[model samples]
Target: MDRQKYTIALLGGTGAEGSGIALRLARAGHRVIIGSRDADKAARACSELAGLAPGAALSHDANPEAAAAAQIVIMTVPHAGQQKTVQEVREQLAGKILVDATVPLVPPKVARVQLPEGGSAVAAVQRLLGDAVRVVSAFQNVSAHHLRDLAHVPDCDVLVCGDDPEARETVVGLAADMGLRAWHAGAIANSAATEALTSLLIAMNMRYKVPGGTGIRITGLEETAEARRT
Candidate 1:
């Protein structure tokens, strides 16, 4: 299958994860719109990214406008702000894929896994967005710092979870485009496992002092046809 190109709206694109992913997406030849509550901040981020990758298609807009313009919307906001950002763009997100990268890590005790009432951050987003929008959860285990440093390939596997099979495949392809291996980790509800794994990784980072960042990779499947093809 030919990789489907998408105009992606990155909500909270002024932040670390959002900007890092935006940079990768832009470099991969996808049109990226940095979306933020502050349009100026989004524009500034876009400018900085443009400098990093000379001729990439990068732009900015307020959350609503960006969401409206894009075919795929990625939510990278903190857990506290995820709902508000999602609500802001709710109307514009219908019939689109919304990749939820929000992990529920209550600060100070961020090392201790803390899942929301709905099981995971993505679950809450799915509830808020309803059936009109397809929600795929991923990137919780990735290090934003690693993503920003395009020179180094991240040694991590992205666990993509979504109720919709096609949506999951789309996000997996996006992760692959960024040079990261991704696996379909079943339905959106399974996102809780991946989200909780972030805290475990944080704990491991501090406990063992892994410099850049620690990541997870699935093993024992090297002989599979899918793995061989990749």
Candidate 2:
């Protein structure tokens, strides 16, 4: 199957995770718009990313404008700012796919699993944006450091979860474009597991003192038809 290109807006794109994903998507021939609370910050990020991936389509705007211009919107802000960022673009996000990569990791004890009252960050986004927007949760386990260094293909699998199967598949395709295997991990409710896994990976990174990013890979099902379909 041919890869489907998209105009993706990365909210909080000035940050490491958002900018890294934007660079990868742009390098894969997608038009990427870096969005941030400050337009100047977004522009600076776009400029820096363009240097890394020359000739890749890249642009920048405020969060609302970027969200309105893109086919898909990804929120990569820290857990504390997720709600505010999503709320700013909620109106522009109707009838679009909003990829929530925000993991609820309360700082001081980030390594410890500490999910919000709603179970996961994705669920909270769903409640805020309602059904009009397809909120797919993913990219929680991958590391920003690894994503920024595009020289090496990541040794990780993205666990995508969403209420809509088609939405999940679309995100899986995006992951594939970044050279990572992605799987449909059931409904949006299942996002809790992946979100919690980020904390575990953080703990492991500290425990083992792994300089590079430590990630997870699903084994024993590589040959499955379903896996290939993704």
TM-score of each: 0.97, 0.97
What clash pairs does model 1 have?
Answer: none
- For candidate 2, lDDT tens digit of each residue in 46-90? 889999999999999989999999999998999999998888998
Q: Could you give candidate 1's per-residue lDDT for residues 1-230 as a string of tens digits?
A: 35777899999899998999999999999999999888778888999999988899999988899999999999999999988888899999999999999989999899999898878889878887789999999998999989999998999999999999999989989998888888989999999999999999999999999978899999987688766554
Instruction: List the candidate 2 regions with Cα displacement exceeding 4 Å.
Output: none
The TM-score of candidate 2 is 0.97
- For all candidates in order, the CA lDDT equals 0.91, 0.91
